[model samples]
Target: MGEMYTTHEEEKLIDIVLDSILSGVVIIDNKDHVIVDVNETAAKMIGLAKEDIIGNVCHKYICPAEIGQCPVFHPWQNIDRSECVLLNYKGESIPILKTVKKIKKDDHLYLIESFIDISKIKETKEELLVKEKAIDSSINAIALADLEGNLTYVNHSFLELWGYGDEKEVLGKPSVEFWQDESKAEEVKNALFFEGSWVGELLARKKDDTDFLVNLSANMASNEFGKPVCMMASFVDITDIKKANLLIKRKLEIEETVASISSMFISPKNIDQTINVALEKICELCGCSRSYIFRFSNDGTRMSNTHEYCPEGVSPQKGNLQDLPVEMFPWWMGKLHNGEAIHIKDVSSLTEEASAEKEILEMQGIRSLIVLPLYTNSELTGYLGLDNVLNTGEWEEEDINILSLASQITGAGLERRNAEDMLMNAKIAAEDANLAKTEFIANMNHELRTPLNSIIGFSDVLSSENFGTLNDTQKKYLSNVVVNGQHLLRIINDLLDLSKIEAGKMELFPEKFVILDAINGIKATMMPLAKKKDIDLKCNINIGNPLIVADALKFKQILYNLVSNAIKFTDQGGSVTIGVNTSNELISVFVEDTGLGIAQNDQGKLFNPFSQVDSSNSREYDGTGLGLALVKNYVEMHGGKVWVESEVGKGSKFTFTIPVENQITRA
Candidate 1:
């Protein structure tokens, strides 16, 4: 290729011209496709020196054409100018704009190739593509508008947010069309134009004209010249968040009111006042004119407004609503009976089926009302209702929930009050019955005791032959009369003592006395009875103290009754023991008997007056059933407790305690 030059100086001149150009140049032999002369720019583009690249095949350095498949040499196709790649010394492909010119100089054909590096232009275009993709995939509704505020571009999220089918539907539309308030939209646009950005919540409308709240951020988009070209905005739907916040606030308020109502019921000052206060709270919270409770009659045939509250300027309806016939409110009462709440948004919306209910409600000046069934133990006893006499206001689910909770609390409180009332009445009736019984026993004491004593004394006199010597049959008959008469007299005395104790008329005469002496006396008196049954009687005085402070007569009576019961229940050849012990400043006395033991089930009734294990007419025991009862009463009067330990077929032990002298004397 150097030989084609006319002179060495001429070749030097051409090299100087090519090296000064910014673009790369290489002259290739058109016949052999081999490089001849290469400029400095082309050498640098291939990362090689001029001497190294001068003899390389043109395809190996700059052109990508394979050997003998030169695109430039083809007759059918022309590659004069094109965007292509240059292969560098490191085998990296560099993008370029290349031009090839076929020229004949000095009768030698050659291809002159020229190219310029375009890496920065390619990079800039790629960056723009990536940014476009990023904006299209964003989650926030993103839109771009022209300077005139007509939409030019919208992302997928924007389509879904505004309920548009596709970009075509919104691309040419004015941005203000999507906003519920056009004036506010204009204000937002003005803010963006003046302030360069605007961020706030605005009401946005969907394609179907349904409005929702959105947090919008708008910014003025500018060109490279720094002139504002369009408005760009991103939107985040905030409708659900707003609603949830409101619901949470509503729930907190309801909870506070419900807690107040529950506290009142827990420790009520008065039921009527509590109900009235609770009604007032419900009415105020519900933003209603009145709140009331309607109760169903026990027979289920009548209803009454038992409790009600009305704010000032409202009429009180409770006085006129008493004893209303249930048949008149068939629909309303049916719902209440089925435990269903009746939430009437507007009384006028009532159909023909509820005409009666509507009439009744409107008569009381109620436009909207919510009546919840009051349940006690799963039975619907009444309804708690709120009336919106001021207007026909809509009721929300939160309101219904509040009313339902209030109804439950009200129902429970009312049920408790009813039970308390019943208990009071029963208590009064029991007191009256006890008084009558005491009076009857008092009358019987005077009427029956004297005759029984006279009968017993006459029989004793006759048996002792005070009048004359009697036959054996006559003597036996007199003995029988004396025994039966004495038993009847004992029963009468026991009855009088029991009545006195039960009526709380009995008094104690506490005195210090030798407890051992009382025990010995009891053993001596009970010995004859024990001997009759062929049973041995014994006394066990195991105590440090021999004295006790108690009612003297009652103490002796307690000992006598226990010892007598031991002797009476002991079988033939069985033994009875009166044991005494002192501990903890108290004396414990136990009367143990080898007797027919009481059944476990019957021991609980032993101390109840007139309660016998075997009370039938033909039972074996002959007790008047008052002796043990009297013992228990007398023991307890001294602030002591009595109990019996017995198993069937295992004998019986009756134990009681009385305070010792040191303890009792201090009292």
Candidate 2:
């Protein structure tokens, strides 16, 4: 060397170099193991003043080693480099990375310790560990692949999702191998590299080669230089989601089908035709080949296939299934009686107890079937069934649910049809009975009227004294005979007229007649009856024209019957008034009386033949209840309507309307 420095100068140079270093530095006396000098950085790192650290034993404040345990004494490892903790003045430990070297100057050896704080590096490593654990525990499957598409890392979730027990099995494998479509996976990878991210659904493959749906979120992973190097992907299993969506779609379809079928039967004009069309719709909805309805007999001992629907080339069983004995299907009927639905995915799978049902189903070539019992009026009336003749598969619950709804609709329709049939039969029977009664009355009319006329003729002759004159008692008896015979004749005449009207043999003999004259004649004829009850009989013809074209005889009869009824119901001294009004090609006639008024509830039955408000055997009024009914029929025969307005204890007003001129064809 060209230059040499003294010991004191060398010491000053070493101190200057140590103070300039960024890391902590300290000098220890090897003989005493005490700190001799410490740099400003060392004093700050140890949380002490330099003067305080310089005289302290190195083991107490700086180094953890005590006595002969110091690594500086080991010859084989004279230079020690390690991660250690430095004790501070407060007895706090500070993590550090340190290097120790032995130095000699002026015949004295020293241990120079160099160290740096490693707190920030340790904190960063802890944060990375937490993130790794989080990724491994995440529910979403996560994986990392290298630029060559080989899996470099996989989390526990990823291995579980792919059905792998260990990460070693997936690592180093091509990422595309785990995907169902390799080409699509590669396309996603290319897009991830080009676009930096990709997100969509993909069909993922399991370890067993089975497929499931997954939602994939893939992104390009970049190195520290910001260059894309690998791909990172996260997947969520969406197989159940897809299945739920399909089930929802199927449910909506079934709901729509049920609504369509329900609408068809709501107001069906022809129930049989509607049932057939409904069966077609149901078959198509359920993807079945046949549907049918079986009706239990009224006695419940037999069943019949009255309605059916079959696709082309499928045989119809309705024709052969008529009037089948109930005992032939014991199991089927038993289940139906319990109101339990029968759903057989495979007919051959039925148990021995259901063998009878199974045999019948097989005979009909049914592979799968469902039957829902039909209940009407709380009684098991029948059952509705759907069959699979060309295809066999388990029926979905939704399909069965929809068909169950359809079964209810069909049962209601059948019940309605049966009720209609019963009503029709009742109506026909009533009409036939009425026709026979009318014929009987028509035949009896001639037979009774001739004899009644002779009795009345002989009574009139005796009352006129054409035969021998009688004494006072005989004369009184003869008067009674004449009055009784006249009443009987009137009753006979009314019965004959009513029979003719009911048989539709009565005709309108139309002619021009004065309405005022007809009213005068009614007034004259009804005055006698009115006087007997001491009732006032008046006619009010309020019209500009009194003449009209109508059936003169029927018109007269209509007025007579109304006036007669008013007189009959009126109490003694009560008034009877016949009022007439005319408007625009029509005339209104009203017969009002001050009498015991009719009840409002009983007004509707006033126009019905033989109907009386007080029909009990014990009653106040005495007369046949046919006058008002006759009035109604005659007015309607002239194309008019009749009505009664009355309030209890008020009075009664009977009104009728007829065209001014007969516009209807004469009968």
TM-score, per-candidate, Cα-based: 0.64, 0.61
The per-prediction CA RMSD against the true structure, in angstroms, equals 7.5, 10.2
The TM-score, computed over Cα atoms with residue i paired to residue i, of candidate 1 is 0.64
Question: Candidate 1, 362: how far from true, in Å?
Answer: 5.5
Q: Report how far off residue 316 is in candidate 2 (Å).
A: 5.8
Q: What is the lDDT of candidate 2?
A: 0.84
Candidate 1, position 268, lDDT? 80
The collision pairs in model 2 are: none
lDDT of 1 at 544: 80
Among all candidates shown, the one with the greatest lDDT? 1
lDDT of 2 by residue, 365-430 (tens): 999988899887678988888998866678888677877888888888877887988999999999
* Deviation of model 2 at 30, angstroms: 56
Segments in model 2 whose C-alpha atoms lie over 4 Å from true places? 1-260, 263-274, 304-331, 346-367, 389-393, 461-482, 584-586, 661-667
